[model samples]
Target: MTEHDALIFLVALATLLGMARLLGEVARAFGMPLVVGELIAGVLLGPTVLGRALPDVFQWLFRQSTPQKMLGAYTTVGVVLLLVVAGLEVDLGIVRRRGRSAAFTSLLGMILPLAGGILLGFMLPDSDMKNPNQRLLFALFIGVALSISALPVIAKTLLDLGLFKTDLGLLVMSAAMIDDSVGWVAFSMLVGPMQGNSVEFHKLLTMGGLSLVFVAGTLTAGRRGIDRLLTRFADELHGGRVLSLVILLALIGAAITQALGIHAVLGGFVVGVAIGDSPSLREQTRATIHEFVTNVFAPVFFASLGLKVDFIHAFDFRLCALVFAVASVAKVLGCSVGARAGGLGWRESIAVGFGLNARGAMEIILALLALEAGLLKEQLFVALVVMALCTSLLGGPAMKRLLYRAQEEDVVALLRRGGFVARLNATTSRGAIEELVQILEPRLGHLAAHARNQVLEREQMAPTGLGDEVAVPHAAIEGLEEPMLALGLSSDGIDFDAPDGKPATIVFLLLLAPRRLDEEVRVLASIARSVIDPRAREQLMEARETEQVLKVLAESAQRIAEERRARGPALADI
Candidate 1:
């Protein structure tokens, strides 16, 4: 490339990054997914709008084949890296823990969606250029589209909704991850014949064997070798070497998968998952990759998708409507049935169904694959894309409402059971013990006005600063009018000498009457469990006034209580 071309490339790269950041911030402010904004930016810059208006300027800005190809190549690499990071974040062990539920939910979700999509396709009239066989391929393509769920997108949504650490979220995430992996394998099998190549059983077996060997070898030998190598590199090199090593590994992994029958992304993701197990490696690698790909190359990938989306040619209202209906119904029916069969209540079933319905990056990738394989026409692909966007964008809010409603019902039921008392969260900068004293002082302070009753003694003890910039302080208070609880958060983190040596920004103070102390302690433990969540912590910190804090705390308390209740009452003594 010429110097001028290099300069132009840099300029375009900077512009893309700036646009992505700007749009992402805007999206966050509006409570929308950052991906949506990035996509919109792409559309604005693409041939559809700005480029068509000022062709010359656009040409000057983006350059020609070489620059475009360079950008595309970079974006492809970014996607592989992104997928690897995503895979690394997933906890595969959750699948084992919830084996029965995961298996049931995943299979039900996939099979129902696949069946619905196929049925819808069969009902559609023939296109001008498409024959019956082509239509069958289209049906299968739609089936694949519906059957697939974007695990990464759903994970992000769960985190955003403060559900990532919840039992429901944990089960859903594990099942979805397993489901995606299986769906990809199924997709490969389905598309194999369409590649115009004879089914070579030997080759397939060889590939499978090789993949197994590769994964096992990487885990056993490669990881240790890489760890040693990274340590050495860290000691030897100054700055860019760390980043270079990560990129090299990512590229090598991608190359290996490309050489194998499966795509490059599979290898990249496996490598990421392996590396993620190492704390030092995962943290450094995540930081480096996030700095490079998200800040620089990711926008281009989203833009490329928008640029290639030919809405004019692919805008069939009827087809789009049909795809939407099928996809939505398939997800709702599949997940709801599975959850109900698992013995979940109606509300919980609906929440699970809606949560599983979200589709983003994975859906787009599947549609692209189908289009490349000639299984789906432009119009069909566009319709599917619209369905994905709708499902992902709308699912979060809908699920939140369902869950909150269920929580309220559970709270009312628990209150009626006669074992529970009033729930309250106190907001104060004072320490947990001091806060508890203050709470008791209003009623019981008179008892120790001049000569201390020593009724409400306070202890500091150990702090519970659970690493991600959060802390929990517990105290055993003595004299109290009645058993009570107070929850408080500080904008500035307070020093509590936690195990991790981090200061506590949030505190949960529990006040209990000696008679009901045991039960109250259990409730306090439950509240602590709920507050430890990173998203919930963030939300609590963001809350401005006492009322807002109470509202958020109440919602959290209700959700936790409902989830516990959903597990059903324990058996009585025989």
Candidate 2:
């Protein structure tokens, strides 16, 4: 409340944010996630490195001030917003479409680690447990902690590896989505009991029931209502107004959940899911909110972790290693086995397992919450953070290496026999993807359904509609020797959510092989460039036969070749 406190809080905030951001950018440059650098920043600024080296300075900044409480309130908002972003990333529709594979992956992926964590919790000596009396609670916390996946990190890793739109990527993403959903729900339910409530059998049972209802209601009724509200205000909700609305709803949701004896993060998460599910929601708006929250609030939240604990004192290498080993083995094996059961190739299945193994920021957030709630001790919290950082570092490179292979090929050459659908009867995106996959069934065989799921999954991530009535639904598949291309011409023209709001008459379903990211980009560019001219598009549209469409494509390819040649070999990287 004093001016001195305010001055210290402001100074501390500035230093933490500045140092964290600098390191985050440095981490990005080195191909690591921002959290890795942020963690380092925390260790350096907190009691670990800084306190040891500069005791007086650390004391003056932290010991003399009552800024920790104020920082806690600020970080609470930061965490709420972060969870909202996490919720926005969860696409329930993708999980639904993934169906059996996702179900199996999520179920087994969750169970193994959860069981492993619980067993680990029990096996550990009383010294590790914050309270030996609440061993069950501690065990359950560990279980939930180990079970979840960080959707943001997984998605980013896939994107960086150019697998975000691939069949393999979709499988990993869907499985993670389910794991996160279930894990968070479990965590929310346990938060109340772990914080202070009686750990009686009856109370836990009641909490479990309430949590289920809360999640179910939020996803079903709340999601629909939020969709309607966004639709009604789609005109007014833009720019600063939209940003304010997101913050407002997140706070309200957090408050409600907190009042319900659950963690406030649940409310924010549910609100995000609801807002995100709206068909009317713009990608631009989502990006704005994501950027603002992450760039500003996220750094503060992560940096504040160091101030709360002495990492050097709390860290137990044996325990940390044990947690990491159990987490990695359990998640990888469980997800891989389930993926194999669901018909993925052994290589692709294992890659999915690795992809979903990344814990990232989610684990840190969970661990921090449990520590603050008195459910976890500093030792376990530190171990969990280290585990998260290590797994995040491992997941991407391992998956990339596992599925590596691709090359540039002409779009025309990639097209298979009988791949052209003269008239597409389907109007909806879902229906169109299925129809295209059915055409691919002879060659793709069992993969037809998988292909369909990935295409739909990619579509949900972003609209594939290129302007001038051309739309491409595509994904790069693992273990593919070559790209697969199919064409569907819709006379009625189907909406593909293009920026121009134009329905696509020329729809191409393209499946690429992973690893040749440059080749993939060139292929997409080549396709988009084909219909760039109105005259060419008009000519292609008038042609009733497949040969006519081929002619246009061939001509477009010639033009592209000419352009590439003109650009000279020096510009090849571009």
| lDDT of candidates 1 onward, in order | 0.62, 0.81
- Candidate 2 residue-wise lDDT, 1-574, digit = tens: 8999999888888888999999988888776888887778888998898899998988767666478778788999999999999888777776777799889988999999999989988898898877888888888888889989998899888766656655566678889988987888888888878865346777777777877777788778888887888889999998898899889888988897888777888888888887877787775677788889889999889988888789989989998999999999999999999998987778777888998999999999999998888877898899999999889888877775676534335666665353888788999877887898898888887777777887787787767776567788987676666678888888889888764557888888887676544455556655665666677777777766778778877787677668768876431111
Candidate 1: residue 482 lDDT (0-100): 47
Let me know the TM-score candidate 2 reaches against the reference structure: 0.79
Candidate 1 overall lDDT versus native: 0.62
Best by TM-score: 2
Error of 2 at 228 (Å): 1.3
C-alpha-based local distance difference test score of model 2: 0.81
State the lDDT at 380 in candidate 2.
84
Q: Report the number of the highest-lDDT candidate.
A: 2
